[model samples]
Target: MNPSEDQIYVIIFSTLFLGGLMSTFVVAMVFIHRQRQAQNKQKLDQIKSEHEKTLLNIENEIQQDTLTHVGRELHDNIGQLLSLAKLYLGSSKPEKQQEGKETINQVISEVRALSKNLNLDWVESLTIEEFIEQQLQKIESTGFCKTTFEHSIELGELPKDQKLVLIRVIQEILNNAMKHASPEEIKVKIWKDGATRTIQIKDNGKGFDTSIESSGSGMYNLKKRMETIGGDVSITSSIGNGTLIHLLLPN
Candidate 1:
């Protein structure tokens, strides 16, 4: 009853073929699993990037909105009070100038109030162009650095958040120029090119090497702020050539 040679050969061939097919199936499964893992990682990375961008945008929106409210309060409330004080001073009788010294006292109080709210409210309410002009006027009043501001666009309609961010960025840049650039003249230009708004600040001062490490928290914060709003900042300067700060934001 022993099996013939042909039957034994057939049985062996069948076993070998099945074994090879099982091995191929296992290898194919491993390859598919690896591919799936790679795809999942890529998707996770994309989601993380998108989430970061969304968070930054939200931060910018909140900051701008808060500044706008503060700006309005300064212009409508404090600014009016100052104007009223000036009017009272103008109408005071000459005979009672000494006795009407209360008018002067009131004016001084108004001035102090205005100064207290200048940076917070006045800046928040002004359009980008108006804010820049006011900043230049302030710098000129100091008589330390001559400032020039140029604008090509009517920026009355710019988003409040964007205006606030731009104002802060420019303020930081100008402060750096005045403190470090030692420049006699500082020029700031704001304009729109197609769909993009640009701000350029240049100073004819003693420049520094950009390659060296800088301990400027203002500049770093400005960069972070701009990034939150999907804006960009660039600096160009050398040991004696002067310094230039450029900011670009989408309209």
Candidate 2:
């Protein structure tokens, strides 16, 4: 069964054609898989964005509710006490009257400062830095400590949700300093480097064991929240030294 040379050539050509066709189909399949992967990533990003927006709305509602509760306490409780003091001062003996009046004035000043922060409208309109300053000012007004804040111009351009989350984190840190640090002063610095914005909070109070404190839910939550936004949190501390919190945001 010997075949001619023409038949052999035809067989070789047919084999090459089929090989080329298979290669093309494999390439097409790879291209389709990449397209599907990209589509899935886009959908996931959209879902994440919607979730963050919902969280921000909840934060706003909580702030408003807190404002109302504080307003009521200031008016119903401290306001009435101050009025009573004023009335008592009016009836006191001459020398005692002067002392009472001076005491009342001091209380009034502190109360007025606190009242300024109770306004929901004012709180709503503030930028992140302004809100931080407000909280710091309240702590400093107690006459126990001083707080300083510095920031780059780029910080003001952050998205509202980003700013909101940062403010809460800073608040938590500030509260920790005020309650536990025994710090004479707290310093806050904010700046931008390329696509990243950073905030550094330093205190002069006695630092603590980082390993022991890392187990706290507050700090863990802080790290988690930052991670959700593609950011990071780092803390450094040593006993008798101070604590430093470095926050990095991908802006």
Candidate 3:
């Protein structure tokens, strides 16, 4: 009743081969699962980036619409009112001339200020470097913050949109430094890489965490603006240390 030697050897060989095959199958399944998970993660990241870009574009469109409406209102409604006031002043009774003159002067002054806000002639006519220098001059006149600007790239030929966006970014940075950072000095630099433009804004101030709860809407808006314009923004800071904002844009 004992099995033959040849039969026993055949049984052992069959068992070993099956065992190896099963182990190979298990390993293959694990590798396949890991590959699928990695693919899913990559897809998720792409979707998130696309979503952020869409949201930024929408916000920029809304901002542009609002600015256009406000500009038109100032030029048409407020400007016409001021013109009417001036016309009335010329024909007012002699006894009331003084009062009318004062009223007309006040109206004219308000109109002029409104006009400046509505008209971005500075952006259209001046290069980014010149415009930044002019802004620095205004800040310097305040005597509140010592400002310095340096440039390694000639930004004179940048597109108007890019120049305007950079200008606004710089303005927001300076405003934040003055109002919140409480820094006595601020520095701005612009340079270029092979096909990229770089801007660095730095301030010695009480820095905050870069977490969601720590930053305000201003920083969020700035990041959104940069993304909308195909640029990237990065902020680095810590408590008691200075804040540095780096912006990069394709040239």
Candidate 4:
């Protein structure tokens, strides 16, 4: 070939090679930019979620503090003043004042109970029946479903950790029933079989097949929690039949 043709071939090859290199570099740059943007977006979302959780926790703490203060005020100050009034009012007679005093006593009892229930940490002060009643009372107060509690299990020396976990498990179960099962009535029955304490919760709702997969993580988490607490959960349900959840606590 002539020198001119050889030079032309070399220039064409160089130009094509240079173009390919530039195209590759541009594509790589775009990919890196997208990767960095994705990473930054993930970080921002994580930060925002953490911030919201922190705020929620702080709000809960403040509410707990307010409940504690109110409970103390009711039991100490209002209860004392009621007693003083009972004495003054009874200074005249018994029949007329007894009714008033007894009413005041009932109020005091309710206030104390309310105070105890306002904070879950103080649930240790209640018996198993009382704790269950408190939870049911909360549910009933919501007016979502009619709840009936039958507790035959006597209160013994139960561990505080177990008490707390049991409360959480009960709450979770009730939450599942309310959210997923759409129950009109929920019945909670507690009984003891020697060393085994049982909590049975039955709901008249559209039960799902337990053998099949479910989108609800609440049931899975409930079972996980019971296992974590050295307890076991037995759930029975069909498509149309109502659901029954039993928790056996080996204490």
Best candidate, TM-score: 2
Note the Cα lDDT for every prediction shown.
Answer: 0.74, 0.77, 0.75, 0.78
Off by over 4 Å in 1: 1-99, 102-121
Query: In candidate 2, what are the lDDT values of residues 101-218, reduced to their tens digit?
Result: 7768866776776676664445346777787788788888898788888887546556656666676778778888877889999998888877777889999998887888554677
* Candidate 3 lDDT by residue in tens digits, 55-150: 555446536744786678668876676666666667747745665677677767766665555555645677877866887787789887788999
Question: How far out, in Å, is residue 123 in model 2?
Answer: 5.1
Candidate 1 per-residue C-alpha lDDT over 140-172 given as tens digits, one digit per residue, 9 for 90 to 100: 899978888888877666665565667667766
Put the candidates in lDDT order, highest first.
Answer: 4, 2, 3, 1
Q: List the residue pairs that clash in candidate 2.
A: none
Residue runs of model 4 more than 4 Å from their true location after superposition? 1-120
Off by over 4 Å in 2: 1-72, 75-124, 152-154, 212-215
C-alpha RMSD of candidate 1: 8.4
State TM-scores per candidate: 0.59, 0.65, 0.55, 0.52
In model 2, where is the ten-residue run with the lowest total lDDT?
A: 116-125
| Residue-wise C-alpha lDDT for candidate 4, range 1-251, written one tens digit per residue | 99999999999999999999999999999999999999999998986675455434434654565577686877787777677667756776776577667767776776776666565556557676786788788789999889999877675767765666676678668878888888889999989887888999999989998888677666786776666557899999998788999999967
| Best-to-worst ranking by TM-score | 2, 1, 3, 4
Better of 1 and 3 by TM-score: 1
